[model samples]
Target: MNRARALWERVPAPVVDIVLVTVAAMDLWPMLWDDTRLGVALAALGCAALAFRRRFPLGVFLLTLPVALTQPFAIAPLVALFTLAARSRNRPLLAVCVALAAVTSSVPWPLASFSEVGRAMTLIDFVYSLATAVAPVLCGQLLQAHRDLARRLAEVEEAREHERMLHAQAVLARERAQLAREMHDVVSHQVSLIAVQAGAMQVATKDPNAKEAARTIRSLSVTTLDELRTMVTLLRASGGHATELTPQPTLADLHKLVESSGTQAQLSGELPPTVGTPAQRALYRTVQEALTNVRKHAPGATGCVELWQDGDHVGVTVTNSPPTRPSLALPGSQHGLVGLRERADILHGTLEAGPTTEGGYQVRLRIPLSTD
Candidate 1:
């Protein structure tokens, strides 16, 4: 069946029409001896009309109706009616074809034959002719409807699959961005501390203070390495469980971050005990980033960090005096401030960073404690 349909599809319309007309001409061979020359010529014209049925179905239909009226024995009109029904998408054209077939089938029978042969043969012939003409028209309508329905269903399925792909890509992009933010927050402060402690050890090499600084650097490096390994393991796991990653640091760790800044620093305000893990971590990282920027950009400057909690939000401010003498350069990219801003925005929070009025630079971060 598949091979036959492929072959039919490849055949041109003009060739198919010629073949159909030739078949119709052959079907009339048995009737030739019973009819006159004019009748045979008319029947031949009806068969020739079939060749144009697909191109101009209504025109072919009108032409075949007259031939069927003149010679009821010819089957060309019935074939032309079927072609008309199949090729034309217009409903009115289909109705016209069916009506012409029915009228042509009924008009040929005589009123006097109502009594002869008990009228059964005439009635049966009328019924058979009508059925034969209408059957192909009905089949063509059904085939066209089926093809239209299948095409619509295929379009709907393709649209749904495209939407699913887009949604999957969006989810993957969000997960990747969140992972990058986590790595930045976890690793940046530890690296800054290592750099600071190493610098102190280099400056005080002969003193006992240099030994303490070296030991602190060693301890921080080892802890940072352990945390990095744990993070890698969590990334490899199937589900992203927050507990599997590093524990979120809170206000308790702010003092260590400040100490690592290696400057005289003052801290104020009693941080709220009720802050949840997310808010606490965000606040901790904000202060850490601020102080790291201060240590690198404003060396040997006094700094102050303050924290305050209201009913449903916490505010943090880190300020440091301008450098007395600017150092050569910093060893890290200056994206800590931008990362802090993005973190605040992710939590639907706000951050402000600029030079303060007191000859210093200040970073202020505010985070909502409640879930969105």
Candidate 2:
């Protein structure tokens, strides 16, 4: 049934109109052979007029009425009436047209013969013609109702899909909120103790090497606490409100970050103040990750962080010299560079990290200055 309907819709409008005109002409052909020139002309006009019934349904129905008057049970007028009924919403107007068609079909042509016909016989014919006229109007109204129902069903389905998406988002938000609470309450408290203990150890130590180790542990723990706080804020913000998040790091905080990194590092060069917030964050994260790596894997090494702008792009490059002393083994997930590369990709940028020719490591990130 669906395939049939699809095929029917694929047929051109003009082709359907032509088919209707042919069927109407066939219906009136026999009556035209026995009629006067005026009757023949009226029949031909009514048949041809069906081709335009879809556009001018009322006018076409009026034209087909003459053909119906010349003969009983005409097809042209019924098709015209159906077209008008489907397109028009005026019920009184449709009822009047139906009545006019029934009367025209029942009345004997050439009005002089009406007196010869019996009243009872005329009434029977009129009743039968009225019943015939009603069929097409009912069919047209049913089609109109079907179209309206289909449109309403489509709208309901669309609304259901939207509701499903909103429900999924709400579930995800709840999960994120719970995770944020865990990080703040449990993880943050533990990291605070590690930083406090390291600070106490640094103060109590006598050997220079032990003192340096304690200071480095304290610095790393403090940095981790700050990052944990930031993460908690981010998770809570994701759960409901953007206003929950603390102010993120930008170029303004670069000096403080380097000063507290527990490494020998130099900050140089300058980007335009017009650089966007996201690019600034990416740049800062790149330098932070680089200095942390130097402190862990390149003990006693010094690093340089340079910021520059080239044409439409702004970038930061961090380079560190080879270790002056043998490095200690450190636990790491090794996802820092991967995360940085992902962040660069989100901003339509790139990150490159590799060893320089001078037995040192270089990490560079370039992103659009207008990145949001």
Candidate 3:
């Protein structure tokens, strides 16, 4: 069946119409003996009009009116009525055309009924003829209705799919903006500290050459800070609400963070006085992010925050034991560790944050330092 349809599709439409016309003409051939010239003329004209029925359904329907008079219950008239009913959207006009086609057929051509059945047609014959006339038009309307419904469904589905795609794109754009803000936070904090440290160094240096170099360093650091600030502003401005210009968390907040942790969180070891503000803030964030993760991923877990300094680096670690009970699943964007990693990179430091063999999560941050 599919192969036949495919072949029909491959055939030219005009060729298909010509074939239908020939078949219809053949069906009306038996009646051609009586009307002779009239019968043959009507048959040829009505059958040929079927060729353009799809393009001009109403016109072809009107053209086949004479064929209905000659052979009322014929193939040619029925095909024309079907074409009009299927193609025309004007319902009243279609109904009028179909009514005319059926009514004209009730009267025989050359003023006589079919003698083979009876001299005068019976009521049953007339009813059957009317039924046959109506059936094809009804079938055509039903098929056309199905086609229209399918087309409407397809359009609705395409619209829904387009909206879904746009929503997905918006989500991706928002996530990109958020990631940029996280990176900006880390860079700004580190750059701000650099500017401050450079200004202090310029003041402390006594030697002329050292002081000149320190001044240059201070100027460059200030410029870097300005650029970072601009970038951070742009990234955060993507959202509808304005970004809050909050102060970064530092060593001063370390005690508060530990106190706030519901777990048995303790801050141990002394922080070096020489540790820069950037390093302090980085350490504070490392501990803060780790503790937050613990609360989220391992509720009821105990944690310890350790801050210390070695000869060349300032170090901090936040460790949480496994949950006392079962872990509680929590909703998180999981951007904390990514931000911590960015901070460490900005300070030319290394951070280790992962699960321990003891069924705990550990975070370690180390920022490099040098003595002038």
Candidate 4:
């Protein structure tokens, strides 16, 4: 069936015109014995007009009008009428064309003689012409109506799909709100209590080592609580993108990020002077998550951070050597790497993370610079 439709579409317009002309010639051949050579001319002209029916529908219909008056057979003009109705439905124009067909095709018996029988025959001719013209016009109208209904149905389906997506987003927002509340109430409270206990320990301790350890614990606890608060606030934000008053970290802040991790890390290479915010954030998070993974899963490993611009893209790579000491910790949510992948997607960038040939874990990110 598909191949048949393909072949039909590939058939040339000139070939179609030639086929129509052949049919018209055959229709006119029977009438030649009546000495009306004009039948051949009218048939040829009518069929030839169909070649431009799609481009000039009304004009082609008008061109075929002569055939309706000169001959009893009018296959070409009927096809023209069908084409006009299928392409565009103008009630007044089609009505006029149908009326003209009925009137022009009516026999001229009244002109030949004023007998009652001749008038009756002319009426019969008019009725027959009207019936023939009406059939093709009705068929074309049916086709046009079917096309209109299909278009409307497709639009309604698209609207329904859009509504479904919006509802899903609303549900996601509500769930995120609930999660933010839980983190703020339970997790933040426990971390805050730890900070307070550490502070108390610093004040009560007498040994220098004990005092220093308590101070370090208090500082770490406070920092952790602050980070949790920031995360919860971001989660509570109402859109796909979280908007904060402060600017997000950039390439220049990479140094501070590595230093804060407390791992034996070194950064090498020059940074681009200007970078898109999305790319900068993606690379920063890529480096941040890579460092966190090393700390949690590959402890006491030396870390390397490299940032550079190559052609129209900026790239960052982070690598960590194998852990010197093994631990019994198992993987949790793996959300850090998941979040990094999402960030790279948002920037239309690429990220790769896995163990390297040298028995070390590595993460690499490459982001194209936006022309805009």
Candidate 5:
């Protein structure tokens, strides 16, 4: 049924109008052939008027009334009535049209001949014509209802799809909230202990090399704690309105971050002050992650952190030379660079990390300078 309706709808409006006009004209021709010239002209006008039924249904129906008066069962009148009923919502107007059509078709033409017909027979004919007139109106109303139901169903489906998307986001937010709790309770506590122990050792150690190792461990531990706190706060905010996290690192903190990275890294170059806070944070993180990787995977390697601007873009690049000593195997989630890449993407930027030809590793990030 739906496929048939789709096929019917595919027929062009002009073609459909032409077909209706043709059918109406053919139906009226035989009946009006022997009638007066006025009758023939009315028939022609009624059929021609059907061509505009969709645009002016009421006018077409009124014009066809004369044809209905001459020929009680004319096709033009019925088609015009159907078009009006299908398109119009004015119930009172439609009722009046229906009654007018029934009356016009019931009363015999040439009023002087009415006395020759029996009153009872005329009354019966009117009742029958009235009922017949209702069929087209009823069919047209049914079509109008069917179109309304289809539109309502489409709206319901769209609402359901939107609800599903919202539900998925809620589920993700809840998971993030749970993860935030775990990080705050377990990971932060452990890192705090590591930092405290390293601090005590740095003060108490007598060996110069051991003292330096303790200081490095403490510096790395404190940095990790700061980053973990920020992550946990962001995750906690995901379940609802964003809560502002204070003292977020920006470009001003880049030099300090590189210095405390526990690596022999040099910071160079600068970006314009117009860079946005979010972009500054991204740049700071990129350098932080790159230097951390160097300290972990390239022992005895010196690093350089360079900040620069290229046309409308500003970025930072962290490069480390080949490790002088063999590196120990380290356990990691291996998602650091992947997370950085995702952050860059969110800022409409890109992150590229790979080994250099001189056996060094380099991580570079470029993002549009945000004036906001």
Candidate 6:
């Protein structure tokens, strides 16, 4: 069916016109022999006018009507009426074309000298002509409706494909951000501990403190590997087990985080025990990233990490002194500050980081506990 429709659509307008005109001439040929030769010639010419029916339907109808009156036996007028009804947009014109076809086709019947069989044959001819005239009009309407429906379906499918592409892009972006957060949390925590313990060992080489610092570094490295392994295993798990993968680290681990940084951080706030896990996790990450920056950028700089809760909100701040050596060049990760800002924004929090007037760097974060 689709192949037939495609072939029909591809037919040239001029070729369609030639085919229709040929058919109309053949249908009129037998009837023209019964009429006057001049009348027959004019009727054939009128039928030929139907070659332009699709482009000028009403004009064909008008031209064919006069020729049918001169030789009512001519069948070309009926074909022209059908063309007009099928292709013309004018309703009044289609009504006129249908009435003219029925009246002209019936006129020859009453004037004929006929026996019972002849009369029946004339009636049958009139009926067949009327049917042919109406059928093409109806078929043309149905074809047009089908074309409209197909166009709408194509549009809907295209829109669905575009929406799918956009959804896939959004999912990829979220996964990338999550992976970045995980890497920052793991690497920054471990590297900060290494730097702090190494600095302590450098100052305590002759004292008993060097052994404890060495042990701390070893433990820190081992713990970092275990956590990384757990993360990889969780990623490899499937389906339902994925949700039951690894537990997320939260603010409860903040104390251990500070101790591992090898910085003496004093806690001085009454934190709510019932804070949301995500909020707690974000807060912990904010402090972790800040302290990591300090250890990398300001060696031998003492610092304090503080967290406080007040009626549905949490605040965190980390501050550290300037580097001792003025010419010291700090190690840097360009993404650290950008990632911290993004994390705070996701949690609907605010973050500020900069050098302080007291020759130190400070990072402060504030997050609302409730979405309200």
Clashing pairs in 3: none
What are the per-residue Cα lDDT tens digits for candidate 2 across 50-106? 999988999999999999898876899999999998988899999999899899988
- Give the higher-TM-score candidate: 3 or 4: 4
Which residue runs does candidate 1 get wrong by more than 4 Å?
A: 1-204, 208-216, 234-243, 259-263, 271-276, 310-312
After superposition, the stretches of candidate 6 with alpha carbons farther than 4 Å from their true spots are 1-206, 234-244, 310-312, 323-330
Between prediction 3 and prediction 6, the one with superior lDDT is 3
Candidate 4: stretches off by over 4 Å: 1-63, 87-96, 109-117, 194-234, 240-246, 271-282, 293-372
State the C-alpha lDDT per candidate. 0.74, 0.90, 0.77, 0.80, 0.90, 0.70
lDDT of 4 by residue, 1-372 (tens): 869857987999878877876786677667656645566676677778888888998899888887776776767788888888888768988989888878777755224543654777878888998998888899999978977998999999999999999999899889989999999999899989988998999999998878876786677678688778778878888564646734667878889878777467999997666787778778888888888788778867999999888898888999999988884586668687878878777777778889988888999988887712
Query: What is the model-wide C-alpha lDDT for candidate 4?
Result: 0.80
TM-score list, all predictions: 0.48, 0.72, 0.53, 0.69, 0.74, 0.49
Ranking by lDDT: 5, 2, 4, 3, 1, 6
Per-residue accuracy of model 1 over 1-372 as CA lDDT, tens digit each: 879987988998888888888888888877677777776786777788888787877787777775565555667877777777766688776766776676666555334544664556656766776777778788778767877888999999999999998888678757755775666566755666775777667566877766755655655565566656666556544255543566657778887777755556888887667777777788888887777676667867888899987778888888899888786675887778888889889888899999988779998988886733
- Output the lDDT of residue 313, model 4: 85
- With a 3 Å backbone cut-off (N, CA, C), the pairs that clash in candidate 4 are none
Clashing pairs in 6: none
Best of the candidates, TM-score: 5
lDDT of 6 by residue, 107-200 (tens): 4533544454366776776677567556656665565666578889999999999999888867765675577467657765666677566656
Per-residue lDDT of candidate 3, residues 1-372 (tens digit)? 869857877998888898889988888887777667867887789889999999988888888888887774578888888888887678788767766766667655555534554635744555666777778789889868977998999999999999998898688668768777776778667767877887888799898867765675566567567656765665656544566554666788788767655456888988767778778777877887787677667867889888878779889988889887776566688788899899898899898988999999899998886421
Model 1 lDDT, residue 234, Cα: 60
